[model samples]
Target: MTKSNNSATLNLQYGGGFRMSSVIPVIRKFNRFYTNVLGLLDQHLLETDFSLSEARVLFEIGHTDRCTAKMLIDKLRLDAGYLSRILKRFEEQDLIYRIQSDEDRRLYYLRLTDRGRDALAKLDARSDDQIRLMIGHLPEQAQRNIAKNMAAIENALSDDPQIRQEVRIRCDLKPGDVGSLIHLHGWIYAKECGYNHVFESYVCQTFVDFFKHYSPDKDRFWFAEAGDEIVGAIAIVGHPDRRAQLRWFIVHPEYRGLGLGKRLLQESLQYSKEKGFRRVFLETTEDQKTAIAMYERAGFRKIAEHENHLWGVHHIEQTYELQLP
Candidate 1:
């Protein structure tokens, strides 16, 4: 109906998609922090005669020995020409060795030399120390809070079987990301259960508080990623009373109806069993019937039913428990 713009047809066929400008600035900020503020680039340039790109290659090889050249290309998504140039530079520097795999002569695998290993250690220590310093600036409680929020953010952007190119799970959560997760959760719950305005700040804050106080070594969080995007998550926290608490179980709306929630619950349950937990427990509202059914399917039995006047007058509460093997 309307006249076209300067570009070609704006149809979805050609993969013309919407772009978020906010992400670019954040990436640029981190780039500056690593190169200019942290002096990471300067450190590598001064200590070794290697450029930043070469240093990254060496670090990757040092951390994961015998990685194929194709592996790096796929993982890092680097341009073949650029990667080849960096590999050649590292090869010239004697920091890495490349060999044709015995089984596949066409496949070139890379290994870091002793010098490269030493360099990676230096980089790891410097990065860890810097992160520790930053965390140390906050109080212990605040550090834990940051770590939990960071973990949520990481879970949201994870790139595993659950999803790809999304949020990262199994990482430290940031300050604002949990709120974002809560907001995102609201949309998912609304879409899935036809319950609008159900997930709020109180629920998000409650789960965030639990994660911040809980010890991860005693517990673990499972998340699903679709193309590096965190579309689902499940947290299992072990209490001193020998009980495992399931909290903040959620999945993004785009990934719903795929049985991912069930898969995550199964994984958490198996993990709980492996960790020697005798039982797992969770709380939900009457409004979330599907989730309640999912819990039941996961072998969770209703342990308690009550009314909650604390949050709202119409709130009906139910607690479910699963006995672990």
Candidate 2:
């Protein structure tokens, strides 16, 4: 079946289960509210002669490298005929020009003229001014929260990999880092491992215990962040006899497969070695095959396993240890 038909059939089958009757209205309301807030319903955008779609096309042409009609169509999901007309108008207005690609004679590259750049700049300034006017009265924290939430929405809806690549890794623990990490552990484990609130309580207690003897010289935390959000984290806890334990290593699900988990683990191991810890070990369940493989590749050998009835599940708890040279 075609994609649209398949989607329709799936929606019919699962729509009730997902409570679409309630969810659909909420989404539609948000769409209407956002469009109105941005004055997208107006014939002209930002009081300019350019329509909303025309302004977007102009902006993308200016910013995108080696822009083309095909790229615009794919990025914006615009109709070919509509986009062609817009491009034709832009050419007539001397706002844009096209050049044939040397490698492909039939393929043409789009570029914005000086006038087009000026138009886009005006649109950008207007957009910024509109947003500033909307949120400028809010507290500084509220403004920051707005931007962070918007980034989150974009990350959830966008197919662009660039959003995931903007993660920053840091070793400093801030005021709310532990609480956020605990929340992440609870949410991620429940979603991925069917763990219950008991598991979350266990994580909380672990942090409580870790803090009892937390030494700045011995313990280290590495957090991978995007904007004001923590997407991944790892920590190494010092123990007696020059031994250390790697704990609380995790990456947000959406931020995985970007080598973030590997980076966090490496940071912990390197910190362990730098602290002159002779042995580094970690405890994890056998169900975590991906993490287990990563541990093995990092020269850790599984030395122990036991059946455990905890976290609302039956699982084999395993210990892996690495001896540093």
Candidate 3:
């Protein structure tokens, strides 16, 4: 069969670049596979009378506080006319009711009737059963990995601030923490700065050196984790003469804007002060403008900088120092 004009236009738009064209097929394949896996192509959802969209509407009405049609439209990106018809059907079936607002006569709030709640509970049970059956044969670790990957996908695509996961900061170093931090540095720097594998080697070497003289009383490491994943990290490596050096300071790009970097920085600086360090300093490259701005704001002043041909690139290496009061 011949391709349609719309398909031809899409090919023209995306086919020019290898990177763009490659991603399109992968995403489309995932969309098709997921729809089949979830039985989303069925006329009704999970053997229920409600269509997928209608079931989602029921779920929101049952769970949301003071739900409204406008809220549904915004949350689901559903067309207004389509949602209106769904709500009307629910009303006719005695599954939902609306109450006019006391202060605003024109505004009405949607609430699930008793029958609606029962229907929603049934849908929820079936969904849980379906998911359990799908993943029941997998090992426990495999199940957890699937969950983590799903969360990562959601966090990557979601623009809603509320969807971002909560990150917790801890100073305890686990068995694989060092390796994970090194991986973060290597992967993030390579992607963000086009750094070669030499940069990863440098990071690995630093950890090796840090472990040689590892002093638990004087040194500390902070890891910002979301669920089981380490998203940011920093460390205070104690030195002679009451000095300390901040090292391995990195944040994953997906978790950067959530104040995690600032939290990690403050934790390290506070620990340095508690350990009676007179000065703390950190080294970074000139290409890290955002991190440099954060350092300056944290009372660190640029003390030294020089052109260095390290990390497979020729760039200005900078040192910023903060003095303890």
Candidate 4:
């Protein structure tokens, strides 16, 4: 059966039935196992005098730019009184200091003291060492599986029903951005789609042409980021006659099968529409059957085709065009 191209149509079943009722114990079991593995039940985390909650407070203080008691309360969802006691403990130990906000005297901002930084540093190192010791003996693949599963759990359990939180989308480009995207295209296509260096060169040349006539107001590119890495990309480059070309649509194999491709395509099409492009079109080889199918589902029709072997592959290059509303 053919699945819907729109990700919103892919529903995850939910209920309070026997199957759902049975899942709680299994989830709790995994939670217990993980907590034990991390030694969270220990009176002191990483053999430090601080409890897990206290260590987490310190870690949050160290990482946050605008540290505040209220922010911590909101983030940790801790009782005001409980957080106040923790703050008092930190102050007594000279781990953190507070300064009154200039605009609001009652609003105090938390800052880590030298002692606090040192303690946090030790806690960070110890936590890293602990995880290393736990996973060090496992094979590299096993280690990756653990990390991947962890991400999957977070994405699945998020309060938002949409899968969008699993990836970040941005239209802004900075220095070295194009090079990184081009490199991603080169490596990902080479590894997964059986494309070669010649294809990479073609990608480079396309970017070169793109930059030569780049316009921020009319042309736009979207990047899909997952955990600090760019996993997918799509671009809409404006042309004459109210037309726009979609280009550089690719997603990393590790992050595929997660609706990122559909989302990226939708973003590009939306941008093209906003840019007043009456027609949106893309050039792709027939080997990209899956992407072609998605385009077809999204109302794109094959406008032209040509036999091309320029990218070290003998394939029919197809031009798919979609009329915008």
Q: Model 2: runs farther than 4 Å from truth?
A: 1-21, 40-46
Candidate 3 lDDT, tens digit per residue, 229-318? 998899999999999999999998888788888888988999999999999999999999999999999899999999977677788989
The TM-score leader among the candidates is 2
RMSD of each: 11.0, 6.8, 5.8, 12.7
User: Which should have the higher TM-score, number 1 or number 4?
Assistant: 4
Q: How well does candidate 3 score on lDDT at residue 183?
A: 91
Q: Give the CA lDDT, 0 to 100, for residue 93 in model 4.
A: 95
Q: Give residue 70's error in model 4 in angstroms.
A: 32
Tell me how far the alpha carbon of residue 262 in candidate 4 is from the true structure, in angstroms, after superposition: 1.1
| Clash totals, every prediction | 36, 0, 0, 0
Q: What ranking emerges by TM-score with the best candidate at the front? A: 2, 3, 4, 1
Q: After superposition, how far is residue 59 of candidate 3 from its true place, in Å?
A: 2.0
Candidate 1 lDDT for residue 238 = 86
Q: lDDT by residue for model 1 over 1-325, one digit each (tens)?
A: 3435312333432344444553565456556754674474356445656565665666778766579777777767788999998888777877788888899888878988787677778777766776776578788887877666665655456564443233444534546555556776776655554444534656667776776776767767766654334577887888876789997788776566667788788878887888888989999988888889899888899999898655423577899999877
- Report how far residue 82 has shifted in candidate 2, in Å: 1.7
Ten contiguous residues minimizing lDDT sum, candidate 1: 5-14
Q: Write the per-residue lDDT of candidate 2 for residues 195-272, one digit (tens) a residue.
A: 999999999999999999998899999999999999999999999999999999999988989899998898788888
> Candidate 4: lDDT over CA atoms?
0.83
